[model samples]
Target: MDFGFGPEDEELRGRARAWLTEHLAGPYADIRGLGGPGSEHEAVAPRRAWERELGRGGWIGQGWEAEGYGNRRLSLTGQVVWAEEYAALRAPARVGHIGENLLAPTLIAYGSPEQRDRFLPAIARGEELWCQGYSEPGAGSDLAGVRTAAVREPRGGAAGLLRVTGQKIWTSLAREADWCFVLARTEAGSRRHRGLSFLLVRMDQPGRVEVRPIRQMSGTSEFNEVFFDGAVAEEVVGGEGNGWTVAMGLLALERGVSTLVQQIGFAAELERVLASYAASHTAPGAEDAVLRDRLVQQWAQLRTMRWNALRTLGASPDPGAPSVAKLLWGGWHRRLGELAVAVRGAAASAGPADWAPGTPYENGLDEAQRLFLFTRADTIYGGSDEIQRNIIAERVLGLPKESR
Candidate 1:
């Protein structure tokens, strides 16, 4: 398949690069590389403002097909070009990515017209932010093991609400999110994936909801533990008891364009590692032939990943594609993190002392240390390596189910 871009795509790339360059100036210039993955706690206020800037420029939700919902209808190639340019420009990490890339598309695909009208506009405006409430305490990888329950509470003046009560673990951007799209067990005696409902819950409802940031070894609180106690959700997406279907559909949409967009950021990280290697004069592996070979391999593998992702775009619906992509990038990133630290030799083993006088301990991890520690959970958090292999075996290869 020809992966070459046409003149139109080049023009779109130019426009996106220009817009990003023009906006990432003045006060916003300091936050150009802030807020991503483990570093999400950095420059929160500026990043939030950046979201609104993106909204004004009509840069959010370029892939959505609905009229008047997005700024303009962009082809898949155009979307890729825009994503590449945005990452290349070192734009502040998007606070609206979950809403724009995940929830909005799911809503457009399965939500009611009322739901779409109410939600899409707010998301497009970047006025509202969203977090996913899928992973529960016991259901990190096995989504079907979700036990967060929601019960209908009939109201006198309105169509009843679903009262949710459970704890969600490792929720990204939960504290900053204005809303959360949750999957909860709505039917009594439901097993596994059945009898679940996708409910939209307000995150700031006083005592009903709580978000506690989970501090990582990287010393950043990007993930959170969100507790829902009698929380209310009036919007049950795709109807109650149909959540398994809706949730699975949303998972399918999570791949494709989003995965490719992620690779652009990965490329930036790779470039940083290479720069570090070049700057080090006396580092242990600076001249090691084997380490040098691995460095070259990392570049080659990233290129291969980009091509693989491009080939998978708009391809036939393969049940295993998302899992495969996850498996590939998860391992690749973790290895890159290791290479990042290894290239610095023994100096990477010890971190700096805590600069703050009142801090608890002396250990202070820099960006490379943080990257090494954070990527350790990449394969574990999303879906475990075991889970991805199981998916490929049973669904794609037609192998027998594992004994559970």
Candidate 2:
């Protein structure tokens, strides 16, 4: 496959590099504040600020159509360049990820005029934040097994609320979210995939809702466990019993564009790690050599991932492509952490005090250690590595599905 960018792509990359080099400066480079492990709790101001910055610069949601972008759209290559440059600058993760990656496209595909008007512009400008309420305790990976019920209200507008009741686990950024795109059963006694509906819910109001952050290895609830014991659902889009498609669509977004950008950011973190390691080269040994070699391979892998994503974007949004990218990143990140642990040696015991650039700042080392510790589950979340293998085998290679 010719993974090379065309002339226009090259030009776009150059412009993106120049823009980031100029704009990404001063206070943004600290790495931790942009939703990394050590960020302080801000109500919603941080997300708003970052969104406004990206929106003002026309950098958020690169794939937004011309009409969506006031009569012009970013080319696919341009978006790839933006992802690269954004990561290169260590800009905060787009706080509007749920809006940008998950909901916006779905709305474009299926949302009614009111839904579009209500949600799109705000997401584009980062005015309102969103979260996904997808995974349930019983259906984390077994998506079809979702038991969250969204019963249709009787004698009411179909625009009527779907009484949503179920738990959503691993909900990222639940605490400050303004809205949720949730999946639940609508028709009783329907099959697993049938009767499911995708509902948009406003989290601000309450009707039997609970949210408790689930602590990660980072020692923070970067994600949350959300429970709804008869929470009200906002307007339902994509209709009842067709939620499987919308939910799958959302997962498709996660696997594709968003996954690609996240990998780029993680690669940047690896770059930071290498820079620190190179600066701190001492007590030369074979272990160091091995780690360096692995780091070099990782750099190559990240580039490969970018090129793969570019190719996918240039063509169609293939579901398999994102899973492959996610699988690759899942392993690569863990390796970075593992090598960092070896690099840190005893200093990891003391935590962040051990990871100071090349000098082994205690904090950097501590963070690296945490990254390593946490990355083990990387392969399991989203969809497990095994599940991805099954997808690639059956769908890509035309092999039979694995027998349950």
Candidate 3:
């Protein structure tokens, strides 16, 4: 576990730092990798342009084969470096990222030749967008209980003409998405987990979909609820009847590397908080000291999450490890938010410092408050904190599974 970089990596980091310093400027607080302007708009042109910049420069795709898609044979260390630098830069999460995070790996693992050829290049190019559709009314934490039926059309014109019909909730960033990777109940009459199937729907089609936003406590439509009608055929990533595995794989990725960015970014934010607190020179008070201690504890938790991700990504593919990271960050985020609110005092509930006009400190404080409230769902999504503990108990700690 040598954190030290080699000669080449040092050179790469230097180059990346220079490029970021030159390119990123102004008050663009939320700019992720190659995505869209916002979740409300279909930023096809803007996203594609950014993707082209990354693709042509060989800066986007990592750990993928060359020519077939984007970049080639990106080292694990390289991936870590990219995440670290990007987090350090404080870039917002990327757009068109659902595909980049979940489907890309599935494509590499089990997608058809045509599927790979058709989707990979554009995904790498960010010409298109993707969203996940796994959670259902009956299956949020218990994803294996998904009931979204994707029956094959009798007179199928396409290879997999699945007539998807069910409801999915908490579909973040889905309102303007062009495509979605939906997990449905393909094996009808079959038991849970065994009957599930993953289907890719072209959301651009009419009479097939409906996406509505779930206004969060933060008053933003970051989370959404999507409905699917039995209509056009859909594509399958990996293979049919393999949706259970594919969905789980995607969940692991979602809660793991895709989420690794948040942990590191939180750590960076903690550092910023530390610097800010030190420079403020507030009067000594018991409440202030308690709040300060809480933030310090939060800093420790963020470090734990980073190390956990590093070990998981670099070592054994423990199915439960991502759950641990999710749980840690969820709780850590809430704790820090509470502390941030405490520091902001009356204004904490307004906004982040210098982020917006008026009392942005209060805004940031409010933002943290909203985040802390949402953290309640952290363990539940991508499986639950209870489930994560079960995993670690049985798998990592070698405890016997419960005889239910």
Candidate 4:
């Protein structure tokens, strides 16, 4: 397949870059590269505002059609162009990506007309932000092992309100999100992937819902522990007892254009690591041939990943693709983090000491330090490497299943 962007794609990229340059001013100017994977906790309010700014510029839903939601229905190549430009411009990390990328597409595919009408507009406007409530206390990678229960209830004129009760861990942006789409067990006596339903729950309920921030080694609390005690879910996306199907579909959507955007950010991080290595005077290990070779290999693997993602952008769902992507990027990022700290030589171990008394700044690590710490969990969260390998072996390779 031809990988080159045509003239139209170039024009779209130019427009996106120009818009970002124009609008990334005032209070938003300082937050250019502020928010990202390990740094989501930085500049929260400003980043949320940036999401709304993106919506105002019609940059939120680049792949959706203009007919129903008034979105610009760009080609897959155009979407890549926009994503690449967005990353290159060092725009603030998107707070609305869960809603725009995962939930919105799934809704468009499986949601009722009313569901789409109710949700898509607010998402398109970036007026509401959403977080995912998939992983439970027991179920981080094995989503089929979800145990959060949602009991149906009737509230006033509403016919099918759900009282969801359970705990979800590793929920990104749970504290700041206005809503959450949760995967929970809806049927009694159900096991594994059965009896589950995808419920859209509001987070503003005072006593019903609780969100406890999960502070990371990176000195951020972007991930959270969300508790639901009789929490109310207004709508179910793909109907009750079909949450496995719906959840799987949403996971599939996760591997789309955003993967490329992520790679661009990864490239930026890699650039920083290279710059650090160039500037550091710490011994000669920074100039080690093995480390230098690994750096080149990282660059080559990243380029391969970008091409693979582009080639598979519009292809039909392959269960292996997502898992492979996860494995590749997870390991690559974790390695990059390791290389980042190692490049600093002896100084990587300790942070700047706090000389003043009565102050709470002791372990204040810099960006590279944080990246090294945070990426330690890269292969564990979302889906572990072991779990991903199992998926590829069993589902893709048609191998025998491993005993539980």
Which candidate wins on lDDT?
1
Q: Better model by TM-score, 2 or 4?
A: 4
Which TM-score value belongs to model 4?
0.95
Per-residue lDDT value at 176 in model 3 = 53
Query: Which residue pairs collide in model 1, if any?
Result: none
User: Please, what is the whole-model Cα lDDT of each candidate in the order they appear?
Assistant: 0.87, 0.72, 0.67, 0.86
**TM per model?**
0.95, 0.86, 0.84, 0.95
Off by over 4 Å in 4: 154-160, 281-286, 355-363
Off by over 4 Å in 2: 1-33, 36-44, 69-72, 157-159, 283-287, 316-319, 349-365
Q: Which structure is stronger by TM-score: 2 or 3?
A: 2
For model 3, the run of ten residues with the poorest summed lDDT: 33-42
Give the per-residue lDDT digits (tens) of candidate 4, residues 326-377: 9999999999999998887778887667525443222477777888888999
Name the top TM-score candidate: 1
Ranking by TM-score: 1, 4, 2, 3
The alpha-carbon deviation from the true structure for residue 211 of candidate 3, after best TM-score superposition, in angstroms, is: 0.5
Query: Could you give candidate 1's per-residue lDDT for residues 110-212 as a string of tens digits?
Result: 9999999999988888889999999988898899999999987766323566799998999998988999999999998999978999999999999999999
Encode model 3's per-residue lDDT on 1-404: one tens digit a residue: 45567877777777777766655544332344323211333333444454455555556567554355765445667766777786676444466567776787777666788888888887777667788888887778777788888887777654646788889998867865778888888877977789777788888777779888776544445678888888554577767788888877767767656666666666765665566566554556523667667776777777777777777777767766766776777667656656655665665454555665432232343434654455556546666777778877887788999775
Each candidate: how many clashes?
0, 14, 11, 0
- Measured on C-alpha atoms, candidate 2 has an lDDT of 0.72
